[model samples]
Target: MSKRCLSSAMLKFAIAIMTLILLISFSFISSGAYAQEKISILIPEDPTFHDLDSYLDIPVVMVNNTDINVGGFDFLIQYDTGAVELLDVNLGPVDHCNWALIGHRPEIPGVEKIYAASGPNPLGCDFSYSTDTLFYLQFHIKPDTANECLTFPLRFYWVQCADGHVINTVGDSVYISDSVYDPYIGDFIQQDDTFPTIHGLPDSCANIPGGNKIKLVDFYNGVINVACIDEIDDIGDINLNGIPYEIADYVLFQSYYIYGPDIFNIDLQMQLGATDCNKDSTYPTVRDLIFMYRVIIGDISPYPKLGDDGNELIQPTALFVQDTLAQEVHLVFPDSLSAIHLIFEGEIVPDYSGPEGIAYNYDGIVTRLLLNPGFSGTDSAVYQGLFFTYTGDGIIDSADVSDWEMRDIASEVGVIGELICGDANSDGLVNISDAVYIANYVFIGGNPPFPLESGNVNCDGAVNISDAVWIINYVFIGGNDPCDADGDGIPDC
Candidate 1:
């Protein structure tokens, strides 16, 4: 063979091998790119129960379906602002890379824009990716949009790889709709078959002995579930105040007896339920009033039976221990309760304007002090005085306190106790003087606070600088109220 022919043959063989190698590499790269190059907005299934003015959180997800490391991407999300207001955006785990909010624009009357980008430290750099949430968009459903389906559309401008390659990315929209019971999985199931069997029959189910029968025969193959109805019953809740029987309950019962149910602007059925203090399966009778009075005077326990739903009623207890030296009374609950309503019956009057004094709204007969905002698991609070010094000798006991009531989230009532807090100077008020007194007792050679526990404003067990600082902050800068570790409403030592 000639030299030229041999060289040409050798060149052709080398070219063929190189081409095969390139084809193999290209196939692997293509498959990896396809696998990792998609982004989506994930909307969770509608909650079992949804109401107007509720907030919903929707997530933006990136499905890194390729072998290439992700450097960055730009995203534009659009949603109906009228149906739901975009309250906030929260970063997700995938937001380790630097992210910037480009701009947010109201595109139309109902629609709005959220534009954001995530990339390398500077820009156009690569970061590895798997499946991860990129961010969350928090939205508040508008009242008018209740029962309506809302859609969130996502658009990805570009997804760049670590090697500076722009990959084609797929994006999806999320749909949020009101919760609805579906009779069938799809459009094909017949309504007759989908209807649940009521007592083994359909139309005549209500006439059956139990009204509806639920059977759990297949223990191995089936699941049995019980769900409590969300309705809260404040039965024996006199005054219809969403609490159990109290002094107000007696007054409300009397008003109902004298003037009839129409005298109060309350639901008659709810009132009847609440006013049934005796819970003898009857409503608005002289017997119920007498039972309520007895309960209020501590003659009989309120609601000594289980609720109509067969659940044990939550009964909270409240008590107060007086700090005689500080002249402050601290409200305490034996168990967790949300709110408390106290009535000073005799000559007892709580000083309502001092530092430790809690301001309250008065309804002539009773002075109301709301311990915490709404219903709280918090069971303690401190008030300045149990009785006004001028009105009486300032000595208060359970007798001077006409009524003490506590309530839980379900409006279940319990008993309450009283005590004192934050009055370090042993004065009748918690004020700048108390902070000064704590500071002097801690820093200088001064007499220690009357109740040493009150000097520990932070309730850290020691009268120290932090306690003085805490007291100063409470008196001047409006810091948190003194700590009550035991929930006894007293600043603990």
Candidate 2:
């Protein structure tokens, strides 16, 4: 045996030992892999558009497998902070074990840990499962992710009795049985007397009895999608009066907030991409109302609220609410635009004007004119624009987030200026008294409007009771304005 020959032999011996070790290790490694095949973890298939900051639930299901008992189980979920905010979690209906436990403290930014055992001392009791959800996660989409399609990964970061698993062993060979077992020899598997029957683990049968020991589990990952709507609309238009982020919307939103949508027939769906004035939720809140108030009072700022998010929202150049009951119409500006113009077919009264109180004229199949081209503030003056209403059905109904989109009232009108479009009695203001006077003139043959056009509030080419009723609703119930003769978005008589 020369030194070179001895070295070669030693190398060969080392290789032989390493190969033997690997072969032995493969047996134990392959033992628990069957769990992944027998078990499954599934997330929700909720394709419905979940509004940002709206709450939702994600279920973790285990399906398509024969019944199996779990003696102990442990796992953790990973999520994205930008996409959702984890609120709470609930154990599956079948997850009731002797000592089922779960904790969701943000120990890690996006991680939630959970664990359960049949018995504390030995982690027994075996929770059986076939096809059922294992757990549920409660979350709300973050408002900041509005108008964005985001995908967050849902995966189990850790699973006990499977990952980093161990079995009754001597040194190398694993005693993979539930009963006190027998093993190969020294350093690997001798004779063991401990029980490793973790019902939470998958079935196994390697030198162990009953094949009820813990085994490795194969894991699958999934994703949840947060998407924008088919098309973006107005933000403040809770009632969808075609005016985004304006006084009419604010009024509707305020009403809805105070009385709820059901009472006012307000459609929240109309607020899809709109609403959320404070940018905290897709739904309206007190904070949003406060923000809108500030904007109206000219105290608006992005601080403490929302920055410019490029979401599509149509701001109504002018909102015309129709009062069919009072046979009246009222014009409003959701925003401030100078040199505004309004055109009508029936007629417009200069009994009420604004800022400079100037009226202009136009020529067409329908007369085009300036309803209020130079109004500084609408608080009192703008609210009174075309103050008319209609009581055709006896109920006061306002537009919602779905009714109509903001249509540009600016057109090639023959003339334009703010010159009191209503006031059938030529009063400085338009109110219920005007409705009464016009009603007297039409039905009772009493004193009629001085110009008659003042009495034609709806501009329907008539001074009938319908116009009086509309005006009454407008004054008493805040009816909509600028009645569209054909339901077209544009305001006209």
In order, what lDDT does every prediction score?
Answer: 0.40, 0.44
| Worst 10-residue lDDT window, candidate 2 | 179-188
lDDT of 2 by residue, 358-383 (tens): 34232323323332211244432244
Q: Each prediction's Cα RMSD?
A: 26.1, 29.6
Which regions in candidate 1 have their CA more than 4 angstroms from the true location? 1-41, 47-49, 92-96, 100-103, 118-129, 144-493
User: Candidate 2 — what's its lDDT?
Assistant: 0.44
TM-score of each: 0.24, 0.30
What does the lDDT read for residue 446 in candidate 1? 40
What tens digits encode model 1's per-residue C-alpha lDDT throughout 1-493?
Answer: 6999868756655554454344434443332222213322222222211335556455544444334343333333444454567776666444444554333454444333444443334533243344445456666656654334333322121111110012221111111111111211211111121122111112222234421222201000000111111222576675566677666666665555333456567777777766655443445444455556557656656543211211112222234444444545554322332223333422334564432333343334333332321122232333322422223223332311112232111211111222235666544567755555555445433445544565666767788666655655555444567775455656454
lDDT score, residue 449, model 2?
56
